[model samples]
Target chain A: MSLTNDRIKQRLIEKFGEPVSGFEELYGLLSFEAPKEMNLKILQFLFDDDELKFRFLTDLCAVNYPDDKGRELAVVYHLHNLVDNIRLRFKVFTNVQEPDVFTASKLFSSANWMERETYDFFGVNFIGHPNLKRILNVDEMDYFPLRKEYPLEDQTRIDKDDAMFGRGGTIV
Target chain B: MSEHQHHIKLPEGSIEKQTTTLNLGPTHPATHGVFQNILELDGERIVSSEQTVGYIHRAFEKLAERRPLYQITPITDRLNYCSSPLNNMGWHITCEKLLNIQTPKRVDYLRVIIMELARIADHLICNSIVGVDAGAFTGFVYVMEYRELIYEIYEEVCGSRLTTNIGRIGGFERNFSNTAFEKLEKFLREYPKVLKEFENLFTRNRIFMDRLVGTGAISAERALNYGFTGPNLRAAGVDYDVRVHAPYSSYQDFDFIVPVGNTGDNYDRFLVRNEEMWQSLSIIEQAYRKVQEFKGADAEVFHANVPEYYLPEKKEVYTKMEALIWHFKIIMGETAIPKGEVYNAVEGANGELGFYLISDGGRTPYRLHFRRPCFIYYQAYGELTKGAMLSDAIITMSSLNLIAGELDA
Candidate 1:
């Protein structure tokens, strides 16, 4: 039998009750959020459940939301159940000041580098990560580049004009 | 015996031997791209390995946040330059999904043709490079000529060779030229003989087989746990393909087989890619036939009627005021976008190339994350190459086909 989003939602709700919220089906993808602490438990449940065998960790990344107080960094996990060929997204948000979420490297080996990348870019401290330092970026770099706090373009570049690039220009 | 007697007696197995630390590359010729691998070697065998990427990190995601939707296509081009049309099409499809633009069947067929050609080009490079790495230089040069032919087809279609920013969100920027079809036909005819010859050169060759057959084998379970996809996972014996599982761009209409291999070794990866090239050729042929069958208005239509997003033609832009205004608006990203988050995946030459897009009803994306397959799969290199011979490790890296641009992006 093919796994439907509704069944998965019901299972998640039954297992973790109030902790799991924001159940949404955006463009046919089931997405929801849980408390940062329950990330491992929810992932384990999703993996261990016979009906919801989302064993494949399709993607793991963190998105920084600077404006959202106490929920500044969202670590998103895209999981796929190969048997049913279905995919669902699980997300957990944490405060930017104390962005500590348990790692899922033990559950999915793919998470090791991905978590390191998450740490490298968004500075989401993945607690329990065996070798969490930096994956893609240089170790000498101090700040997280992906966080909304940094400007997209190099602020120091004087050669390029902002008006020419359509940044400050008004469309005629 | 006199010298040994002079020294203190040592306990059995207590003598320490230092493993040589060899740095393979961030610029070595054998690496094919800029990636560093520090290997601890016990003679010719690798004891442990550590991979370092980000030599070409351009912060594409960060760049995407600042650029308008249409302008981001060029950034996608740099991700996998070997099969850039696939990346372009993937980004376009993601944008189309976000905007809820339904492309026509003819457009879908056109996309499939371009994507398959890109797949062929990508696989040709990967397979031939594996040959090159395995000391069969002739096969690499032979397949490269065919890759140039594929590039000609791309050039004819998009006016660019390597990093082809091919299509628009709604559909193609323009209609496929007659010369493009001619080039495609020429490629379709000539590539097969070259591919067959190339395969014959390496497939049964005892040296190539011996080097690759048992080298860098990853179990299916470990591959899945490590989020392997496309040919690598398929080579590991799992029959999961994004095209078959989740049909996009008229992939469902066509008939093709997803090839699988047993051991997920370098040889299996080579074989799986070779078979996929054949499948991609068939798919393009079928798509081309379907495209030819379209009559009258359906035949002439290329880009969809979404003027707000799709730029107007050059002639129309010069002649009409509204056309000029709409073109400027689209280019400037003045058009309002829907507030939503959408995840779209296309079967890139490597694997499931996915884009997670979030829009806040603004011209620019709120956040965009690209699920680059190479970046995900390259994580297992340390595990795969551990305890393997140094020569075998080189072949393993080549077989994985890790493009540094995609890896670091």
Candidate 2:
């Protein structure tokens, strides 16, 4: 039988019940979230299970929700089971202060640089990541640039007038 | 003092540092684009290597957060400049998925034609560059003519060639001109012979085989673990193609074989890309026949009828009030997006170019992530080149098809 979303959900609930929550399907893609600490366990279950062989780590990235108080950083993983040709999105949220999730680099070699990239942008420190440093940014940089705290434009710059550039002016 | 010993005394620390450290690039011509590989060498063999990318990092994901839907198309173009039309189509498809827009069949066929042409151009360049790296420049020079011919078709369809922001959200900005069809027919008529000649030059050549065979070989197990996709993964013997697996943009309607190779070496990658070009040609021909099956008014359909997202025609904007309103609204980025997350991928020349979009019912995407395949390919470079000959490393890099623009995006 082909692996459907319901079977995957049932398998997850049977293995690690209650901790895995917020299962929803959007545009035919199965997406759900779990507590940050249980990320590796869930990922391992998904990878090792004979029925649910979601081995391929298609993509890994982090999203920042500034207003979401306790859960400020969401680390999202897109896993694919090539045999069944199905994909699912798994997410784990961590507070921005201590944004640490277990690294999947040991399981999937692709996660090394992806975790570095996630660390570079959103400052999500993957726990026990070997050589977890910035992949796409300068090493000397102090702050994560992709966070909502950092605006695209420098607010303090005085080189140009904001009024002339269509900011703080009447609607055109 | 003895005459030979007294001439010069060697530095003690210099001899202590046995292995030579070589910086292969961030600008070296053989490395092709801006990629820096710090290799520790034991004579001519690479002992260990660390790769440094991001010299051309432009923070495209950060830039996408502020831009509206249509403006991001040009941004996607720079990701894989070799196949900008594919990236443009992928972005458009992602937006369409989020917006619940259904493009017409003619539009799908038109997209397939453009995409397959881009694929041919990309593969020919990669294969010929592999030849150039292996001391054969004739094939590179020979295939450049056909690439220019493909560019001429792109020019006919879109106003620009490289970095072509070709299509609107729903479909192409305009219907295919008659001259574009003529150019397509011209390309279809002439490219196969040139490709065959190009393939003959390197496929059985003793020198090319010696240089590429068994160099940079990775097992299918390791390749998948390293997130290899597109031709690179297919070359490693796993037949996981996004077009065949996911079937987006009406790819299911077309018939084409996904080529695979056993050893996952440079030679296999070259052969896989070469076979894919033929498959792309066949797909384009089938799509062209399907396109011609439509007549008169049905053939005239180009862009989908979604005025909320698709830009209005200039002539219609001048005459029609609704068109004028939509033109202003779309241009000003006033349209609200549906709150949803959509991950849409297309078979990019390099790999599966996926767009992960999340909207908060805002004009701009709340968060957008581009699953750049070149970036993934590059992370595995150190592993691919370990203990290989220094010259073989160059061949491995070229065979992997790492575009600096896409890699550092």
Candidate 3:
């Protein structure tokens, strides 16, 4: 029961109108790049299509395509269909200045944390996410740790002056 | 306004109270890691619990970028140290897929043997930690003792119990030691008895049930939605397992049951894991049989495409000049690894442990992402712990079986 890549591509194209430019299909993984504007609608199609009911939102993450000329930030979503057991991937290419994509947190509540994580590290903001706070980093942390611009070596020093774990930082 | 540690419950605050804050950890023993959780409490119940990670972040992903795929096995050691072999093997497999390396059948069997051992070791620790959190001190010690025995087998096989750099690009760096197999046979014989003891002690006990029943209950709908894998998702009645749902590392040949739970409660999750340990033992038994069955067969000979990545054999290096030069080249990691991206998910003891590696025609991977099970489970932590009692929080969190190493990594 090996699922070939061609089957997923044919189904996806038939469901959502022609994908944005630079859509490529690999072995068993499907990847398509959509402009930041059309991400919500394409996601809606994926959720609505009976054949490709990607009910299970497996993973929502972002990667910085720093060197890519046309766009800078690529927000990739690795979604899986629970009933069919096929995986589909869709990404949005947004510029570095305003890395905003509509939040799919309403569709999958788990997206709430992942979006916050993407925001914390890559500075990609989910437009309508209810609580978009830094997940991996502290509240006071100003920089996103996962971004390429951020220093590779963490500069936050552990303080030894407080009674409640440390001094400089209030236990939060 | 709470005063002393005793009766530390929140004062008469309204559910609508916006400013009431509750500090959960960093110093608290509940948070297993050197981690902190701050909660905005609303009268004895949590309004919001915000987790602050990077307290134990060691820049592992960044460190992987500096080394070749072979050398990065040690760094994977820290990601899931409880199941370092699983992490080590996962990294190697992903690199192999990118380089299109096919390992020998004997090596595949060897891989299964070690992975099953690591799985049992990891599950033992995870289940015992649940006991530790539940105040069953004696159970934790017993489980740890058995885990130490598993470590003994690991030590004999790879010379290190924690960070086992066993697999090369194409095959294992060396043959399995005879002493290790003998030790494993003895351990397998006794492990079931100890596991039965564990089930007798905690799985059916009323006190344990009180702490776990209905605590941290997540429905199948919610579990699947959050990318929850492994026991957490299975506990919610989802039969999906990476080994079965998506097989890798010759897992297709092996037969194992994907246990599912009904309620998604702490107890059900515990049941799933307990049964899972029993299942893991069976898997190891079968894996061992396969190892014995395929002893001298030349099942595979396809070397990984990145020739400069794998270390050459001792005989080859001593006799052949090209092999000697290749060994030196591999030492420097001056290999032209292809520009490819692959995502490999392994059914680790705790959950679905996946590695997303994007190599850019270089020796080292350009980007490496870990689809950690604990992280996914912890995302639902607030929903899991919201109205449950403080004791339930400890037990339920334990039942979720989230290792802090995997969570933070």
Candidate 4:
């Protein structure tokens, strides 16, 4: 028999300890939002700790949670460690006032791009990042394309003479 | 001070040079998409690189949300334009999985032939583009000719060349035309000559080998960490291929070797892709035989409730009230697809092309997330490009095969 989802949940609780406003599982994934202070330690536990060598960051994408009562932007990290072939997910909430999450670049090199992509797309600053810059969208633009409030303008809608779509490059 | 570890291995207390950022492609042919890569250079080498997108963003995900389950088929064609049939099949099969519709044995075999054919087409482009980026343009022309031959077969069935919306919900919308097999047979017979010709162009050529053999190297460990899949993963020496590991569609019936490279370098990527194309050809040959063996005059594939979405045949609409009613619903795209979510993946040319479709019991898909191989492969570009010769950068990027629609979407 394969490792059931319940067995995986029990394993996470056993490792993390009795719940104290932390940890939830959904859709075959165990997730929790940790405070910025203990974020690094918690991640180390997940990646380096004997039980969970969550080696693969299968997807480290950010999801904007605008209506989450109090939170402004939430950074969602999805991981899958093939050692056990189990998937894990976690989120770090960043409100408007403090939009920084401790960088995981030190833990996994791939996180460098993942973190930069999140920062580039969601404006969730990754503190302690060695080199962070805009990726995938035009640098001249001030707004992030993935942000909900940002206008989803097609190329035709913008003036053809505009720099981004200009024959020379971004029309501005 | 070599400074090439793929990950951030910056010197302690590194100073950010008052670097001027140059945006490449948002017009640069080399950026491969409508991607604007903001590169800050300390002289010629990059200090930092950032990629910005949406310039070419058609927002296929948003587009899928508006169209019916079957309507989204063509949207996937744009994702990896190199092999539209594979994308279409991947999207449709994902729907099939959610609907739990078992395609007839004949339908499975038909899909295998088409997907494998697309695979050969995809690898040829990838390998030839790598050759082009290395300044050897002839190889590109050679592979592209074969790609055209594949498209000719595509035209025979779907009547379109590049964007062949060749799949329906449960199976193919139509049968493989006899004309398609005739073209395919001729192409297969001569593809070896062309493949051998391309082999002469690069495999033993001293100039091509020097540029690619050890340049822009990645390890299986690092590639795995980066979530690399498909040819890129194979190039890194991981024998894990989705087609073999998790056999979906009728992949289990086929026997094929997953070619991998010892050193994950540009040259190895080229070699792996070259071998994979040959394997794809063999798979196509075997599948073509099976396709011919099928005695189906009936539609080998059943569709999602056609009454609501697909246009009734002219005769059916003229005669049957049920089909006519269904025809109106289909034209308006008012029919509901099964209410569920599924992530169906196929071994696409680039890698495992997975489609995650969520239906809210509506005509259109609620959310469709393409597990784009190019997007996943693009994650390692920053690492691969670092410290490589500036000329090698173009070759490395092309080998990465970052299709814009998939990347931006």
The number of the candidate with the highest TM-score is: 2
Cα lDDT, all candidates: 0.91, 0.92, 0.74, 0.72
| lDDT by residue (tens digit), candidate 4, B33-135 | 6776677665667666665655665656656655767678888888888889999888877776776666677777778878888888888888888887778
CA displacement after TM-score superposition, residue B370 of candidate 4 (Å): 2.8
- Please estimate how well model 4 matches the true structure, expressed as its whole-model Cα lDDT: 0.72
Ranking by DockQ, best first? 1, 2, 3, 4
DockQ-best of 3 and 4: 3
- What tens digits encode model 1's per-residue C-alpha lDDT throughout B253-285? 999999999999999999999999999999999
Q: Where in model 1 is the C-alpha error above 4 Å?
A: A154-172, B1-17
lDDT per residue for candidate 1 within A1-172, as digits (tens), equals 6889999999998988998999999999999999999999999999999999989999988888887899999999999999998999999999998999999999999998899999999999999999999887789999999998887666666533344344453333
Give the number of the best model, judged by lDDT: 2
Q: Estimated TM-score per prediction?
A: 0.95, 0.96, 0.88, 0.80
Which candidate tops DockQ? 1
Give, for candidate 3 chain B, the lowest lDDT window spanning 10 residues. Answer: B295-304
The list of candidate 2 runs beyond 4 A from truth reads A154-172, B1-12
The interface root-mean-square deviation of each model, in the order shown, is: 3.0, 3.8, 10.2, 9.2
lDDT for position A16 in model 2:
93
Worst 10 residues of 1 chain B by lDDT: B9-18
In candidate 3, position A83 carries an lDDT of 72
After superposing candidate 3 on the true structure, give the runs of residues whose Cα lies further than 4 Å from its correct spot. Answer: A1-7, A138-145, A149-172, B1-21, B40-48, B296-307, B313-320
Please give fnat for model 4.
0.29
In model 4, what lDDT does residue B232 have? 88
Stretch of 10 with least lDDT, candidate 2 chain A: A160-169
